[model samples]
Structure formats: C-alpha cells, structure tokens
Target: MRHAGQRPADMPGAAGFRAAKWHTPIGTSRPSSRVLPSPARVRGPGPAARADRAQGPDRGASVTDLATMSLQQEIARDLQVSASFDAQEEIERRVAFLAGQLTSTGLRSLVLGISGGVDSLTAGRLCQLAVERVRAAGREAEFFAMRLPYGDQADEKDAQQALEFIRPDRVLTVDVKPASDAALQAALAGGTEFRDAHHQDFVHGNIKARQRMIAQYAVAGAHEGLVVGTDHAAEAVSGFFTKFGDGAADVVPLTGLTKRRVRAVAQALGAPSALVLKTPTADLETLNPGRPDEDALGVTYDDIDDFLEGKAVGEAAFEAIARRYRLTEHKRRPPIAP
Candidate 1:
C-alpha cells in the first residue's frame, strides 16, 4: 500500500531515508511525500553543528537542508500516526470513562445536539455506547439527541444518517431561527446609528449557536440530563467554537482528540461513510450558503490537525495557527472580573 517513492521501514531505501544526512539548501524542492519531517525528529542544531554552519556557505547550506528535511520527515510521521489507532479499545475506554462521569453527576440521561457532522456523530455514538453500558450494568441511563437547525439545514440528510447509526433513546428537532430572529430583532429594534453594520452574519450565527444551546438545555432540564458537547482538541485549541453556545456542555467526551482522530473514532464506531467523509461545515450563515468550517478557520483541518498533533508545519501554516491560537485565547478563557 506504499505509494510511489514511499518505502516501508523494512524496505531497501527507508533506512537511508531515516538515517541519511540531507545536504540540500533550505528551500530545495522535494517530492511532496518527503517535504515534511516527523515532529519528534525535528530538533535544533547542536552547538557543533551550528558552529560549523556559521563557518561557510557549504556548511550553512547543509545545516539548513537538514533542518528542512527534518521538518518534512516530522510532518510525514505525524500523518502516518494520525491514521493509525486502537479504535475498539479507545472507543470502549472512552465510553466507560464518560459513562462514569455522567453517572457521577447523578444525571439520568445525556443530552447532546447532533448536527449529522462527524464531531457530533462521534460524540453521540460514544454517548449511546456509554448509556448502553450503563443499562447493562443495571443502572438507569438514556441519551437525548437534538437536531438544531437555523431554518433548513442543507445537510439534514447527514444528520439523519447519524441518527440512523447512533439511535439515541430520544430524538428532538428544534428550529432555532425564531429565537435567533427574535434576538436579532430585539438587538436592532431601537434602530441605533450603527444598526445596519452591527448585525453581521457572524453576529447572527453566534445567536443561532446560543439559541441551539438554549433548546438543548431546555430538554436537558426536563429529562434531568446533562448537555454533552462535541468539541475536540482541534476546535478547542483553535478556539473555533462559539462561547456559551456549542461550547457549553456538562461533559465533553471527545476532548483531547484532534479532528483526524475524531474521524478515525467515527469510522471505528461504524458511522456512515457519507457523514464521516462529508466536508465539515459550520452551517452558520446563509449569505455564503455553505461556508465551510475551514473557510472561517483560514486553514484546512489537515493543517490544524497536524499542528495540533505536534507536527512541524511550514512557516505560513505555523504563523496562521499561532495567530489564531493567540487571538482566540479569550474564547477559551473565563470572563475577567473587575
């Protein structure tokens, strides 16, 4: 299954690939496969190496080459590791631990919003599995999956696919548009001087997210269930989620996992391929129609996952990620007290 020029560890050239000392310049063009290095292997030049590189062009070029090669190797290694996991074992352990957390709260059930997206689908499936384990142990547990669409989600079919797979104890559908509209109307009702520009799509999207949480908490209140969230390490790191909106949850089972890991978990849990492979979308604004999550992120999930997994990223990717992580620090923190 190795692609062209990609050798296995036991293959003839792989040893050289691993041990070979690259002597090319920093910006030398390499095959796509070898352009990035394993993060573990990317290390700073030792004192002697740095001294040698400073001596002359030949040594400096070679040092730069080694650094570049290390970066490429690190990235490739991260990618390889990302695709491999102990799916069943991980799933079982996560479910058991999450079930313990849920039961510890004395809640009768777990309620979560299912968008038919991979994150929610994976979290929902994990919750269902946890509830099943709870019941098997003769404890009372149930799962509530809510479908919250702003108006009409184009990807409702994906949600259906997820529901068919997860099959929670109860399914609830609530359109958050009315509340969203009411909030927007109330905000701009006074017709302030800046009313026109104040109510942007992102503003409305935040309202939708908060409204959805309201619906979720409403159901959780009646059923004595805790709200579960789908936020994972990837979104949590980048602060890609809305505050007090999708981010509000009693238990986040999928925390500390990157998006790539989430997908692997979904596949292990038998999520439908269509839902698993579907491009992730926020479904927030109607103006863009189908603005992808990556569009708002300013980077692809692949880059985010790689960066989050500690892979050595390119300069541009690193800067973009760092900027985002820095700016979104507020989103991940509690409000400042006077």
Candidate 2:
C-alpha cells in the first residue's frame, strides 16, 4: 500500500527525495541509497537558480541577492555567506565578541580543542586573544587549548605548530583512543557488527569525535568554561561535523565565514601560511585515514566557497553542495519540540 504513489524503497527517488549521492562529505557513512546515475541525477537548480526562479530567471541578480534571498530560495543553506571583510576588523570583532561572552557569562575560561586545522587554530588564537582582552578589562579569563587525540594523531606535528601559534594560557592533552576503543570493544562483545569494515571504521570515527568532545566538556566543566567549536559557513554547507561531538559547542566564533574567509582571519591572526592552507580533512576513518575533504565532498573547497560566497558555480558543483546542505539540516538544528 503506497501512500501518495510512493516509489519502491530501492528506487532512486524514493522516500520523497532524490536521495542525492554522497562521498561521505559530512565524515559520516555514505547514505544507504543505492547508486543513481549522474545523468539521471536530478539537477537541483542551485541556490542561485532557486533565487532566480523567485524573481524571473531572466532578471540579472542583485548584488545583495544572496543576503536578501527569500526564504524559499535560501532554506537549504544555514547561513548567508558574505563575500569578504576587513580581516583585521573581523578579528577584532571576533575577539571582542569572545570577550563579551566571558564578561557576560562570568566564565573563568574558554576551552577549545586544537586539531591543527585552520578552523581550530584560528579559533584557538581568538580564544587566547579574547581571554587576554577580558583580563585587561579587570576580569579573569583563561584559554585552554586542548589536544584530544585518538592515540597518536597523524597530524601531531601540525598540532604542535598550531599550539605554538595560538599560545593559549595552558595546553592539555587527553588521549581519546582508549575510551573510544573501549566503547567499540563493548559493542563488539555484545554481538554488534557493522555492515562492513568501512562501516565499522565510520562508526568508530564518530566515537572518536564524540570522545574528543567529551574530553573538552569535562575540562570546560572543571574550569567553569565554555566549549568552543570551529564551525563556519564552508563546513556548515555540508554539515561536515559529527553531531553532538564537534557539532555541539557553547560558542562558535568562526560562524558565518567560509573556508577562505577563515584563512583570511588566520592570516590576520599571524598564522603561518603552511598551517593556514593545509588541505582540510575530517581525518576520521581508519579505513581511509587522512582523506582529503575534497575527496569526500566530490567537490573542491574553491567551488564550495564560491557557491557560498554567491559566485557562479558549475551545475554539478552546485547540485552537490545544495544536496549536502539539504540532507544535513538536522545537524545544525536543535532537537524538535512538541
């Protein structure tokens, strides 16, 4: 008994959606939907296309079209991606914002995990700057740059570099592998087997992420501080974070900026060029360790940044991005209330 002429479960467009293919962009498992041919792929008129539909496709786009697009044209994206800002001004604003958070909440510290990635590294630097500003204002605040690694992370050297750049008040390390592996062992002992090795690796990867966050929260709680996350518009477009793990944060200073914009802020913060431009990756899966984020997304950050920044992108890139944004809406939202 199909409701509303539902297609079979195995069908490409089943479940009321086209079931856009994923290269596991969000650092999670690929969606369960079976392979759908590219040509047969439904080209979702991307954000620009959707926006154009609202006010006659023939009309040229307004300069601020993206910032002011109607709800229907913009529902997929979580934030409006601005083109650029004065890097120093953005930095000062973010530092001041962080300082405000501390002053208003009276929290003694800002705790963030430093993964040696641009996002975390920038946020860590900002956190240090913010705490310093708070202290200058006759208040006490500390920035704790935590290293919650899964045993020995492949990027320890980069992490050290980030630490040197951030110069946080204190640096702490918590090896999350022991705890993460324990959970996996328990699940296996209880007769739980994932679909395959990659599936198991993906699940364990999420465990690692959650454990890392657990460490951050514990440290934050001990010092009466807030957990900071590195989420920004570029990553947000694909929801490229583990839910409740890296995703759950008390504050995100890097919100609404794209990857390139984040790098600009990093430069303003005096980050070394090498660390600022490292290829982004979730680096989660043991099966495909250190997978480049571009590989996972099936699109490049350049394309993502362009689409997010309201520049024209090829149809394929646009569809891939819009699809991820649509699929991962749940990651960005709070739990639904009755």
What lDDT score belongs to each candidate, Candidate 1 first?
0.61, 0.67
Which numbered prediction scores highest in TM-score against the true structure? 2
Residues 164-273, candidate 1: write the lDDT tens digits: 99989999899999999998788778662322332255467667877898998899899888788776656654555655677666776776577888898999988888
Candidate 2 deviation (Cα RMSD): 10.2
Task: Using lDDT, give the best candidate's number.
Answer: 2
lDDT for each residue of candidate 2 in 1-338, tens digit (9 for 90 to 100):
00010111112222221122122222122222322223333244443212112221221232232322232135323364545568898898888888988888888999988888899999899999999999998988899999888888888999999999999899999998899999999989999877667657766777787788789889999998988878777776665666556766778788778889999999988999999999887787677777676665556778777767766665556566666565554444444357
Q: Global CA lDDT of candidate 2, please?
A: 0.67
User: Candidate 1 — which residues are off by over 4 angstroms?
Assistant: 1-85, 191-199
lDDT of 1 at 121: 91
